[model samples]
Target chain A: MGNRSKDLLQVEHSHPSSSRESSLLVGKNDSKPLQQKSYLQGNPITVPFPKSEVLGKVKDFIGVISEANRNLRLYAKDKPEEYDIEVLTGNESEYIKMDLMLGIADLHTPESLAAAEAAIAGCQSVINRNSTSSSLEFEGSSEEEEDEEEDDGGEDDDTRQSGSHVRHKDSELQQDDFLSALLRSHQKKKPSKIIELSVQSGSDCSIRSMAMATLRREGKRLSPLISPRPIEALRSALVPYQEEAHGLRYISTQAVRNRMKSVKSIQKITKAMKMVAASKLRQVQSKAENSRGIWQPFTALLGDIPSVDVKKTVLVTISSDKGLCGGINSTSVKISRAIHKLNSGPDKEAKYVILGEKAKVQLVRDSKKHIELSITELQKNPLNYTQVSVLADDILKNVQFDALRIVFNKFNSVVSFVPTMATILSPEIVEREAEAGGKLGALDSYEIEGGETKSEILQNLAEFQFSCVLFNAVLENACSEQGARMSAMDSSSRNAGEMLDRLTLTYNRTRQASITTELIEIISGASALEG
Target chain B: MSSSAAVPFWRAAGMTYITYSNICASLVRNCLKEPYKSEAIAREKVHYSISKWSDGKSEKPTIRSDVAED
Candidate 1:
């Protein structure tokens, strides 16, 4: 509290306009109706949520004045830190009541996002406005935050979870990032021009949304702005947020007789999805096609190990999560079963890590015992390295094996999709193979330009290579799946066209026979009447 | 400079890999020869209807179901 008060005085003295501007920005960004209404004197506070959130500016101005008063009083006191701790205790109690008032589970997400967004823009401007003092203040806050986090975290197990404390640290780090970025961005501006600070939170790509859906959940507290950030890097960090693939199980063949008009409409939707879907397949396919591309060397280095001394083997079968994709899943399942038969015996153990729902439904009936891990809804999104890498990590964690054999449909042109297997040796096996000197083949030098022990480098290389191989295998399988579906749908649509013609012919024939019968009856009746 | 780091940061957190690769794939997809791309897309120019799998079970002529058949 004392530090905040001190900082406020320093900022107000340095730049008079900033104190007003800080409150204005906060008010504008407050999507949450945090009025901080006067319920202070040990009384239960009612929910003061006015229906109109337009009162943000009014409430925020009042909040700033109160903040300024509190800070000023604390600055006057000898021990500001002790007074601030009391303020924290008071706020924490009120926040507990506020949590109860906000009934919705995800209410905090948006509120936090807004707070973080404002913090980013606000902190950046503060650093830009007064450079030297802000940096010092930043270090102080960071040190305090770290200390607070250490106090929060004593349990070793809970650290595995990127807990609430870590997120607080992340937000502080984010402020540091903004400070650095603004230092660079501000340098380009005219010296005399005042830097305008407007918070842009609505942009989904902005740090607001990204903060909530961070890769921290994966136990990797990576800085968002360490280097050039490709937005897709964090794509997997976001929950798949897609319709579950299992829902497709309920949808059967077209129930309505698809008229010419209906067929055209269906084609339009398919076309829109396909334009994107096909190109993705084509890109992955192109990479696979290339004989001497830059990625080719990487692919080859990490590519198929023809034979590994199979003691305990894991067959990771790649198949589509959704049904109606024809034989994309079936062929892979067939090969998976065959490998299981080949590798499984008295001494050797082979486990199945099925990667789709379609195969799981089939394999569960027969080889339920060998199945270690089954992941579905994977094909709901396109394949990416980070997602696949995470998946590889998960698979490795669950199953300890000598050889990791990946069975996926290798795309060979439009019609031919071969159910192929790519084997990646475990790190220990790789080290063993290196000692025996089988197929090191100048590949080791290319992949890991070594300074460390050869074995240590190989261990890291093996894990990384598994991710790459798995990533490629998934892409190849996806391309094959798309091609297989296109051909299957093409033939089925043709069959439907022919069936429509046949049905129409039958209808016409029945109509003609009925008309002929009616005409005969009419003629007989007329002849009888004349006689 | 040789990247001494064992795994790319994207491999861990902050989406270094998924975004980078998805972007790369999209870029490659865009670079395809124009004629072949347009031709195939045009071939799929027309194809709609609701209530799938309803036909295999429905014996009645679809002429009277919902929308007035033309």
Candidate 2:
């Protein structure tokens, strides 16, 4: 209490001389500057906060101020270093992708083709350079001379030809005669040719299932054409090229498979797009037709109302709850806003009954203090007459309005959509205008006398118009909703197809690289084998 | 099951004698422990006498009277 009184007395003393201003002194240990110091020295007490906590708060505030800047810097500083590494790696990968594609093309084109041509030339040159030595062995003149001598000796010996018919007992005598003749021929012939003659006669004669004849016929027909040397060389040269061709074929098959997948995906997308467009077009047309049927009777009845001054108007704006159908809801909202703006006067007033969420959101901002009475989850099912009439009765009973208008997307055709406003409460002025323009052809045709009375007829007309307008609103909304859905699905399918196409292109490029490498190795190997 | 009827006489006798002798030896070995050398030998003799007749031989051995009675 003493301290409080002392502090109050100091404040009172300092209040008289306001120029001095350092009055609330509690303790010298206080780090905070006095509030009176703010008045005296004009230096505010600035609290120094922890840098890390302050920076965190600043970052939070910056995120609210500009999300794009904060996100970009945060991603750069805090994200994995692999992102930059990936960027560099992606460049390298792209180079590899290009090289791979080019390699495949080169394998089919100048590089591999040149290599194949060179290999073929080398093979042909080898054959040409070897032709001299090869021809010497091929002509085999000395061998032929020996062969001729053998043939002459074989022709003179009837024993050699007739031994095939030798019976079991006489075969021994025939064999003795054959050996004596062979000896006589060997003595008569040239010494070098004698051996060949014996070999030829023995080979020409069948063994008659005797092992002795086979033994005598051995080592005949030994020439260069039948030699294993050339065959061995040809086989060794052929192996590498054949292996290369097989590798190329495998790579080409994979490339073709990848391309086929992309082609199939494109075909699927195109087919799906056509289906969606066709279905949406049909649905939109049908809904338009049904709505048209509803609107015709409504318009006719609207021509019967007697009111002219639209001092107070009730606008019922209908739009699709879902957006994606080009500009249907936007135009409906725009037309509703225009009507509201035109009716805002001292005497004139405009009220709104929103049918869809999209239109309600738009109109809610403009209408000050006049909130919309929105019925939630009412548009999913078909519109019932009882519900529609209840709405109509509520509007008619609670609100005193001169004009009632409906703003909705009117489907003129499959391609043509328009925002249309039709008056339901005041039809006489519209009818007068139609008459003035020489269009009084349909009013007298609908008039029935004395069965109910003119006033009763007018009341019935009002009820019918209300039903028609409500039905039209629901049908148009359904059509617009379906149209939006179809287009959205179509674009989604197209995007997926495009992604598949790009992946296939990448796959082809990689496959091409592998094929090119195989081709190079094959050419080098074949050349090595040939040399 | 009756393949023994087709087997040679010597082979069948040998197989039957080996099987019976193995079974009798294992049963006596499991019952007797080390350090009872004389008693173990007597037990083995008794087991062999009991099982000897089970062998399918041309001249079959008879079981000892004491074992048969037991």
Summed backbone clashes in each candidate are: 16, 0
Best by lDDT: 1
True contacts kept of 1: 0.00
Each candidate's B-chain TM-score, in sequence, is 0.30, 0.26
Model 1 Cα lDDT, one tens digit per residue, A1-531: 133233433543443433223332222223111111111221244233323222233235334544654565557486766544324644453211111111111111223222332343333221232233322221222345435323432331143122212211222222322322222222212123222322232221233212211211111112222222222222222224322443432332233334534655555555554555566567667755542143355446644565666789989998886665578798899999998888888999888887766887888777776777766555433444445666666566567889989999888877889888878787677766656665755545555454555665566566666667777787778778777766666665666566666655665665666677678878999999998
CAPRI-style docking class of model 2 based on DockQ: incorrect
DockQ of 2: 0.00
Over A1-531, each residue of candidate 2 has an lDDT whose tens digit, in order, gives 133224323533533322111111111102112211222243234333233232233225333433433344468578756434325644454211111111111111122223333344344322322223321211222355446534544453354335323222222222333333333333332233223223233322222212212211221112222223433444456668867876765555455566667667775865576576567557555655765676675555345332335677877778766555566778888988887777668988777766666776665565623433443334433443333444454445445556777777766554456677767764344444446543334554565654454444454456457656766665665565555545555666677677767767777687778778778989999999999
Error of 1 at A39 (Å): 99
Least accurate stretch of 10 residues (summed lDDT) in model 1 chain A? A96-105
Q: What is the lDDT of residue A406 in candidate 1?
A: 90
